[model samples]
Target: MEKLIKIISNRAVLIVLLILIQLGVLFAIVFRFQNYFVYFYTFYLLISSAVIIKIINSRSNPAYKIAWIIPIMLIPIFGTVIYLVFGRVRFSNKEKMKMAMVQERERMANESTVAKTTIDDGNPNAIIQSNYLSKHGEASLFEHTTSEYYPLGEEAFKAMIEDLEKAEKYIFMEYFIVHEGEMWDTILEIMVRKAKEGVDVRFIYDDFGCLFTLPHGYDKKLRDQGIKCCVFNQFIPVLSPIFNNRNHRKITVIDGKVAYTGGINLADEYINRIERFGHWKDNSIKVEGEAAWGFSLLFLSMWDFVNSTESNIEEFIPEYAPGELPENDGYYQPYVDSPFDRETVGMNVYLNLINRATEYVYFTTPYLVIDNLLMEALCNAAKGGVDVRIITPHIPDKWYVHAVTKSNYAQLIEAGVKIYEYTPGFIHSKTCVVDGLYATVGTVNLDYRSLFLHFECGVWMYKTNGVDAVLQDHMEIEKLSQQISLEQAKNVSFPKKVVRACLSVFAPLL
Candidate 1:
């Protein structure tokens, strides 16, 4: 009786009943409403048929194809309807081309500047330098930059504040998340002061990235303070379904010479002062030199897109030529990746490093939801006798996401890859060191979201001492992490495994 009542009370039943009643009324008025019914059914059938054809031809992953095939075969009409609205790629090709064109322009403008500084005075291994240029198309330029790797967020914050205080010409800051907290307050104060002093302060924050953290009209509030602000991809409540795409980049370029990038965000939690998760262990790198110009261009490109204004590239160029630092480091090539383009530059860079690893590959990411290509690359590396170790969070902030992360454990473990979970708190660092020769630090996570949905940036370094520092930090993190054995992973509860399996099916969508 309860089940019957529940079924009767369902909204679907009400909708169906309304449709039937409307049909009956239409039939009764057929003499007068003949054109209305004819046009309605005709348009419906035309849309349904078109949807079916699109579903039959749409591009998708193997898992998505198999999952969608069942529904497409079972219910042709409704399946086609759903696929047309949601199954197909959400972004338009025209928009993608526009993004690509913009990026190409920006790259072309910076290429000359990048090429002029290719001689590495620090003189890294010739082989490694050639490999980077060949594999990533990034010429290893002489980077006379002082890089300070902050192992914790507090140290990074202090450094960022100091750099912001020293801003003279312009301050271009971009981040994925900036919550209303002590960290943001401090930064906001600096931005306001800089704007007041006619310092040309500009900001670009991801809209979806800070959906709940920021209130409506926040951009206007910043503009009112004389600080130029642009929210990337304004969020709309009505378009809540398309929330997968986001700007997942954190960049700060001060005076087009000093820059900062890493996993750290402008939030108190990152500093460990407000412990929402655990210790909030994260890392950031501060760069000051010709390399900082690359980051400045990246920020200016996004700013141009948001503000719909042409960026004067020459205006941002430093008056004095970038001279080598007293203690110069090797080339630092900081590049960005956009989902708008088909090329997965950042992902390919990582895969190449993993494939070329002769000794060891160390990785730290908050999530480990990987696609087939990445999984096979890492597994093959491990099988070929490379020591592969990854550190993830033990206390996950998202239980479902954590389950999805662990679901791939069986395959990785069987392939000889070691896994560890940080016991103290969440490990939010997205970093990798391969053979102690190549190290990457940036906003790219080991997941589909970072790889295929969001805008991300990272610095690829070879022969820079920063690689050693990142490896040392990894070693220190290993002490705080607990290794997960194949035995333990295999014995996970059946119910939990079922949930993980279900979540894995939707990993791409997540």
Candidate 2:
């Protein structure tokens, strides 16, 4: 009886049941009025036609448009309605106003006139990418910042726990997934203890991302322990495109003095306490010094946006004392990407690095599913004599996504780009290193979801120790991975090829 009750009360289960019920009623109404359906059929066609026109004319990706166009044209009954519900939502006037305010607050928080660092001493490639991000992506370049790169999630976890122990002012954590296991338990223990000691602790977890990992009332439970918790975009039974906009960021800030961000989540799978897909692999970068200020304001802005309350963000603005500033390790700029800005910051950053590579470019991503533009850039770089290499997972967490990832291999391999699959297990790290001088490590996958739909973040480095560390890690992983040749990549079965073709049609949605 208890198991049955738990299943019935599961939040994800209840939402699915409610949506199914609504669909049933709608279909029943249509069938019951079949004699008068001739009038409605024309109306539905008009709606679908209008939606197709809007999609074609909108600033959406061409492949994304084709994905929806085929379906709406074929099934005119419910296709238009579904498209409206799951389509990419443009920034509304209200959203624009709120986001503008948040951006302004972020600017004011980092308004210190710390002289910008010069990159002419090293490579000019860093200067071009850094200037692009500063001018358009709102990522400010900083010196006097020290950074360390961890090639594994567990190592970064240990570092984060140590930093958490030293928090005197506040702690901010935002993650996509927070499963209740040893990983989260260890972190929560520290967060709760700090809260008891008068440290302000704030946590934000995405509702959709943690739907199955955590209980629905997890936020309330945290609040009861004196830890402030806000669930990002609470999942409701109603279908709306707003639910698709997820906060897919992993960030931990300690008193605005230290921070960490990468692909690791607060889950056992991330740290490999227990693995779902062979040995789980990930990476992270630790930032100390004034650059941690970037992550601090990023958290506060989202806090204000969710609560609909304008906070006195100046209160949390970090000011680094001259003695407190670390040695000039190198240039560090941690930036975030949002759907509202009409800028795909993560994808563009990747493009810039690939385009500007002099010797080689390396990437470690779980998914290789990409649009034609990105695919073309990879091919162009490889065909231009740049040694381009990518490492994806051998043991996939999702079979369908792995299939899509493999579907991309043959095309890239044909263009002389090397593709390798991790032999031991899944590689969930999102990292890119170019010419041994520039690198970015964070939570942006190569799929459309991470590139265009989700809110993402990463740290761009130039002439930093972190860059060398990331390049070394990539080289080591390449040794442990299996390279796919043109023959192997093109050896798919006939039926499987058909399946891949169909899946590719909807790759934008995937």
Candidate 3:
């Protein structure tokens, strides 16, 4: 009875029930007005045609277009309605205008403090990448920056707490998840103390992502503690296309001098305090020096978007006196991606790394659902004598996602790409290391939702300590992971194969 009540009161369950009720009402109205069926069919046909044209014209992945078209061809009336309601990317005009305003504000901020990007003439490939990000992603590279990699969430959490305690100017945290547990409780104590000390402590968390973990009035509670908090893109009771674009980036900036970003979130499970998935494995990186300014800008941009207030971005810019800066070692370029922007910075960065690799490419991600572009890129790199390797989860947090991930194994294995599953448990780390010289670490995942739909961010490193650390961690994790032989991939059982095939067709939608 207790389990039944829990299910009845669950937010996800309630949302599904509401959607079903709406669908039922629509069907009833259609049936009751049967005599006007001819007019309704004509309207449906016109809408379907218009939708088909729009999908073709829009600059979306070819696979996504086919996925939507298949169902539309099968059931025109319902499909057309669903496509307009969900498939259309340009759903919110207000959101588009707001994002434009935010970008303009950022541009003005950058103009105030013009930091010239210095290129390492020795590493031509790295120079190419930095230029690409600067041109398309609107991010500049920094030469005087250093980084430290944490192979586990606990390690990152320790470093994060240390940095939080040292914040004398401001502390900005933007994350997708924040559960009220041992991890957050400890952090909250620090943040509240910092806020009371006259430090500007602000936080941004996604509404739908934390719907189950946080209480409804949690933002108010945080504000009561003198911490400025806002929920990003608040979830509505009715269905809408805006929900597709989630704030998936995890970032924390302290005093505009140090920053952090990666798969780790503010929750106990992330640090393995309370194990839900067996031995939760993850990674994070701490960046110090000039590049930290980029992350600070990223956080402020989102904060402005949600609060409708333009901030003086220059106020937070780091002023590193002589000898206060970290050693000028390697190149560091921190960049952000958004669904609001037509460019796919995260995906392009991954693709560029894969294409430029001469020796090897290694990556670790929680989910492996990818499109043809990424699949082909990995396969081609492997086929061209590059050692392409990927590590996914053995004990999955989502069974359906695991099934879809497995569906693509055969093609990759056949192309000489090595696929491995972390044997101990789920690997939630989002990292990519190529040729031991280039790398990226952040919240971006190797899946359709992350690549093309969600708002994400990462740091592209060249010959930095971060690159070497990423390669070292990849090697260490590879030992604990079990490789999937090509024969094993080919020998999937018939029933499971059928289920996977069906799931793969809709994987993009998932």
Point to the candidate with the largest TM-score: 2
lDDT string, candidate 2, 1-510, tens digits? 999999999999999999888767876776676667788887777877788989999887788899889888877566776787677566678978988888886676556533565566755677889988886566788888899889999999999989999999899999999999898999999999999999999999999999998987899999999899998888888767887689999999998889899999999988899979998889889999878877887788788877777767656666776698899887899888888877889999999999999789999999988999999999999999999999999999888888889999999999999999999999999999998788999999999899988889989998889999999999999999999999999999999998888898888888
What ranges in model 2 sit over 4 Å off?
32-34, 112-124, 319-322
TM-score of decoy 1: 0.85
lDDT (Cα, tens digit) per residue for candidate 1, span 418-451: 9999999999989999887788899999887787
- As for model 2, its CA RMSD to the true structure in angstroms is 1.6
RMSD of each: 7.2, 1.6, 1.8
Model 1 whole-model lDDT (C-alpha atoms): 0.78
Model 3, 1-510: lDDT tens per residue?
A: 999998888876777788778767866776666679888788777878888998888899887888788788897577766776677666377878987898777766765665786674667777788889887665778878898899999999999999999999999999999999888999999999999999999999998899888877689999999999999988766756776888999999999989999999999999999988798999899999988888888789889889989888768888878899888868888888888878999999999999999999999999999999999999999999999999999999999889999988999999999999999999999999999889999989999899999999999998888999999999999999999998888888899999998888778788
Question: By lDDT, who's the top model here?
Answer: 3
- Sorting all predicted structures by TM-score, with the top scorer first, yields 2, 3, 1
Report how far residue 312 has shifted in candidate 3, in Å: 1.2
State the C-alpha lDDT per candidate: 0.78, 0.88, 0.88
Identify the superior model by TM-score, candidate 1 or candidate 2.
2
